[model samples]
Target chain A: MTQRQALSQSTGGTARGPALALDAGLLCILLVATPMTGSLTLLGETLRSALLFLRELSDWMTKKKLLAGSLAHYEFGVEKLAQAWTLAIALAMIIAGLWIAGLALDLIVTGESQTTSGGLALAAVTLALVTLRSGLQMLPFAQPKPRAFRFASLLVMQSMITLAALADDPSIALLADSFGAAFVALLMTAAGARLFSTAAVDLVDHPLNRKSEAYIAELLLEAGVEEEELLDLRTRRSGRDIFVELTINPSRAGSFEEARQRMGQLRRALAEQRDDLDVAIRLRAPGADSG
Target chain B: MPGPTRDQKSKEAAVLYTSLADLAVVTILFFFAVFTSSLTLLSEAIRVALMLLVEFYGLFVLRALHRDRLRRFRFGIGKVEQMCNLAIGAALLFSGFWVAHSVVAALLSVQAASTPLGLAAAAVISAVNLLINLLGWLAMAAAARDGDSAIYRAQLRARAVKLAASAIVQIAITIAALAKDPVVATLFDGIGAAFVAGVMVTIGFKMVAECLPDLLDHPLPGETKKEIEAALLSAGIAGEELLRLRTRCSGSLPQVELTLAPAGCASVTDYCRRVTAVENHLKDHLGGADVSVVVDARKPAET
Candidate 1:
């Protein structure tokens, strides 16, 4: 295993544990509050929280399995599986979002808003919990910046809707609750759409960024590989694993031994620069077909 | 990367046409489901919507594959297809749960019966849906008849399940609309929705089970492995020179990676030719496969 992979395996659970616990706690609170208050907004929150909980649970389980070395046999590691999980989460979010939106629209159309007596209290509690959750997620160890930003935006939106629901008129309060649920649904759908696109690209083996590609080429050149000798170079990323495959015509070296030594140097140099990288160097024979 | 073959193009076109047809049917069903407010129709609508999502996803992946857009992937598009299947199965399971939940809620609540007009509309729409699903099933079956990939086979199976569910929906709606007894109507409605849920769960479970092992990079079947070994032996690759051989499936594509200790080859050119020959031989034997052969130039005693 590469050093980065080892580090990730050791610290993966620690990084995700607190966030998962927070999500579970918030999910439980919303689950209990949704039925008690009959609040559509709370129901939406509960569903969103449940999906988030599932996502975290899957990540945790995958990391645990990685740590146990059970997934080592996978040639490309479990990066594709992680990408698949992301796709699943995106689909679930979109489905949940549409369902919630449908329910809210039905209520609006029928003009049969139920009296949610404790909705304000439930909203306040949830807003507080989500605020805390967002704060925790912002910590470096918790999640990626984009995800943290998503949660933070959700906090702002949740706060706005909660304030709106504090109206004196019951009818206005109900409208606020319905609109709040609709807003939550929109947020979820947008996030899901973004995640879906990213996962789709990754699953198709999108190439590494140009800067990284340039750096790898520079490293190979620095390791005494000639520019013309480098026949082909391909780089791609899956989850946290980066793969670099190089096809080289090592005719510059006088013998196979010298060529082998050059390949080792290239591998060691690349490994030192990026621990997550898996490098494959293919020595092409003169007059051989590229295939 | 090579361009997609004639058979591949035909398969892609078939998938695209089916998905477009599904989109049209689902769009119409959505409106009818909203108007009728029949639980059975609503469940069917939701189920079809989910299926459409997966169908479109599969179509996108298929197009990408045919266009050679994913050539940078060393293992080909097998994992991507598997991921698509996993998403489809997961979506099916989710829809099944939602349908089951709605069914339970309806059974517990004292609900008003649908208007006569609504019931009539639902029955008509369901009958149309049944016919569409039947046509889709046949189309997919024809497409998969030539022995296609995992995605195509899965689509065929999904189409079959959709056909069965559509039949159930049509019958349930017709019975509920004609039956004089309210109890019988409600019972049939619940049963129909429950059956749809059951169908979804069963197919979803099967897809997930079949795709998970492949996604996990489990080895190819023992028989296939033996064949691969025999093929390698016949190709003049001695057991000692073959340092490592790993075989796995990506969707329906077999992937084989071989590491060889380039022992007695007169030159690098000779070794490359030998490896190329071995790859071609294996590809021919395996029908088609992604075969990668790497030469380990280090001596066995280097360690």
Candidate 2:
């Protein structure tokens, strides 16, 4: 196997197994609670949880396939697939948000107030436990803190909504429940839209950020490759891997061997910067077509 | 980098106009679905909305290509196209599930009544949807005929599916309106929604299957591999001089990378010319491909 394949395997092994398990448990609780309470807020939360569960399940399955070497044939790696998956998740989130908002609006307009039930209480307890667990887990890992915080906030909001539904005053309860559903819907939509835009840019094959591009230029200069000799430089990212393709006119070099050595030095410099980079250098004959 | 050809620009315009038209029709259909409370119309609306999202995405890709925005991508934008198709397929799959669920729910509640006015409205909107979809389909077919673009072909296929689905929706809604028995009307509505779901699943599976191999960078077909070898031989590359050859397709563009042992050439310039010849021969043989040929100076025997 190639170095990339080995790297892919290592990346695959880091799949969030515990997080997936937690999501599955949350989904089960929401599934049971959604039908019993008939609260729009709970239903919206249920749908969101379901989508999150599916996303994690798909992520796990893709990583399993990666570890099994099923995707080893992909020369460019499976970063695009990961980006596509992110896009899918974003689309699903947006759809769920719209669906929830529509249902909440219907409830408000039709004056349909659902009664509180034991299921809602149980769901609230479950959310509290999950939120606490997620927050505690984030204490040890700084990288996942943002995601954990988001999850915790969503759960806290759901718990508060559930508590509102359990209020004795029917009129106030209905208002809080309906408004809470709307709030969750808006939150989901805004978050999904943000993720969608980011994933869309990646799917469009945008080049690396300006900082990375500048760094690459600095590296080339350090390797004794002049700006004028560089005919082309292209950089893109797929998943966790960075791909750099360069075309150089080596006419000024004393010999072809010396130019080849310079290319080798540039490759080493890039590799030292990032192990996940895949670099390809092409020597262009003077006056040759860059295409 | 070269800008998109006139042919490509024209194709992009066709896609953009049709997609905008589709969005309008689907939006009208969705409101009508709400007004009429027609299960069939709702299913159609949901399916078309998902499809239109994908159509607009394809159009965005085409415009980007025409504007030379993706010129820096070394392997071209084939992977991007495939990824877009894959997303469309997933959306279709989700639509199928939602429609199936709606069908089951409607069947379970057979007493659901439809007002005469609502039924009439549904029938009329379904007809309008069918007519617009038919026009869109024909336009896509004509556009696809002008070029061998994978995006256009995929768009054409999607249009055909939409046309068929609209026809199904029209027939089902018409029958439901005409039937006197409430049970029969509900049954027709359920069947219509079920059939549309089936169509979504079938096309979604095809799109996903077609994209996976290319997206996964599977090797070129045997025939194409043989053609590459023949082109290399025709370029006067000795069998032993060919150190490594790898071939894969990115979207519709074939990508070939070759590592050659520089044994026969006398100087670096001679070797460069030979490599260029090999690259040109392969590109010509493959019609148009991203071909990169390099000298493997590390080969012990060749060195």
Candidate 3:
């Protein structure tokens, strides 16, 4: 990619890299040492076993008059050991969710097949891939940049959530009730695609994108910075900032400050340039560099 | 004359080329290991092949960052390097997973290749790789002599690590090739490759983080503070007050805020001179802390 494209993509969140590395390493260490920590995990498992035993005990107690109390041992066992084992559980949840959802959908939807377990696996993998990369992208923000792609990406994420909720399969009720992986992935993909399309438009230096269009419109209304002759305007985002390098034919001679302040004000309303526009008003003697 | 100047950067680039050569030679050996159908040789060659990217990645990062002052974020493109680093790490990690997959497949399958040719290639490539590593080692040692060169020094250290790892891989490949089993060779090579990639991803991740912290507006070095603090203290003020300080990496110098000890406290000219002096001190210490003095009475302690 060109440098501009790369810089445009380098949002502040990329700083997450160090934290991710640190977190992953910590997770691995915890996974390796879990056997020694037979404290919480073992306790939970023991409680689960006790609960199972009590189920039998309670039935017998009900029949006899002596010890008639039901010993209800709550067993939410093995849930606390969210180490590498968490990954296994996540995989399982993904699998079970897919299997149930697919079966239900297949029952209702004529053309759909319940045996697309592999596709469900692929969906889980895809989500994992996106999440993993998104985490890395967040790493840049640690250092702080003047601009970032927060607005665009966040819009995309939100859309995914909305689309997923509204998405309908042929067996819509079954898919929704069963909470299938296929259903989740499908909605997510549709939402993401919508958001990405907008982002893509923004990336291509679309002047009509909300920010620039507002900026140019604002500029036209300004009496101070407006010149009768300004043309071939182009603009693009750099992180949170918007840079515009265009030629203007001023209405007669004017103070440079007057022109600068106007353009500066316009910049502020658009991106980081709005309140933090760093303006470099270079004077052009009509025929400066080219002519 | 203080140091080798920009030439040091060129030398680092040269070091990268040398190490990549070592990898290329090892890859040649790798092909033979597969051909000879020696489990050990194939595995060893695969191991070496796996690590090739790690060496290349170090080169890429070191070479990219080895120049110029920190550019102002106003241009917004400086962070492009970080993006490139992140992209590269993701690619390497994905490739590592692929390498692991292949290893598992080979472990289960009856895959084999021709052997005698692989052994001869391994021998030849090992000698060539050793030579390349030596060149890289010399370049690294030369670069490190300039202790003041933080960026170049980092490059040197990264290259040295690659050189050491490549040498280790070469030894393993030779041993595996002698064992005469292709499966063993594939296993050794595949595992080794994945491990090397893991290391690269981790390293790349870290180096990028260092730069990212600055992007996040994390506090920079205190040289600017020292100047501001010295300026306030120069006014003969009593007690240690921080005076408000805000800093951002703008253009040429980082804009630093140094709050004064309030109105009734000290000589403005002397305070101003001291502030100016501090600004100069900051500019010297912090390649370019803009040294802008903001006299804040409310946040006096931060000065």
Q: Indicate which candidate wins on DockQ.
A: 1
Give the chain A TM-score for each candidate: 0.85, 0.85, 0.34
Highest TM-score against the true fold, candidate: 2
Docking class of 2: acceptable
What TM-score would every model get versus the actual structure?
0.82, 0.84, 0.41
Sum up the clashes in candidate 3: 64
How close to the true structure is residue B79 of candidate 3, measured as C-alpha lDDT? 30
Distance from true location, Cα of A240 in model 1, Å: 1.7
The prediction achieving the highest lDDT against the true structure is 1
Instruction: Please give the ranking of all candidate structures by TM-score, highest first, separated by commas.
Output: 2, 1, 3
For B153-269, candidate 2 gives per-residue lDDT tens digits of 777777787689879988988898898887777777777879988998899888988987776566788898888888888888878878777777888788887777656455557
lDDT of 1 at A274: 76
Q: What TM-score does chain B of candidate 3 reach?
A: 0.57
Per-model C-alpha RMSD:
4.3, 4.2, 18.1
What are the runs in model 3 whose C-alpha is more than 4 Å off? A1-238, A241-291, B1-130, B143-151, B180-191, B194-198, B220-244, B248-275, B284-290, B294-303
Give me the displacement of residue B196 in model 1, in angstroms.
3.3
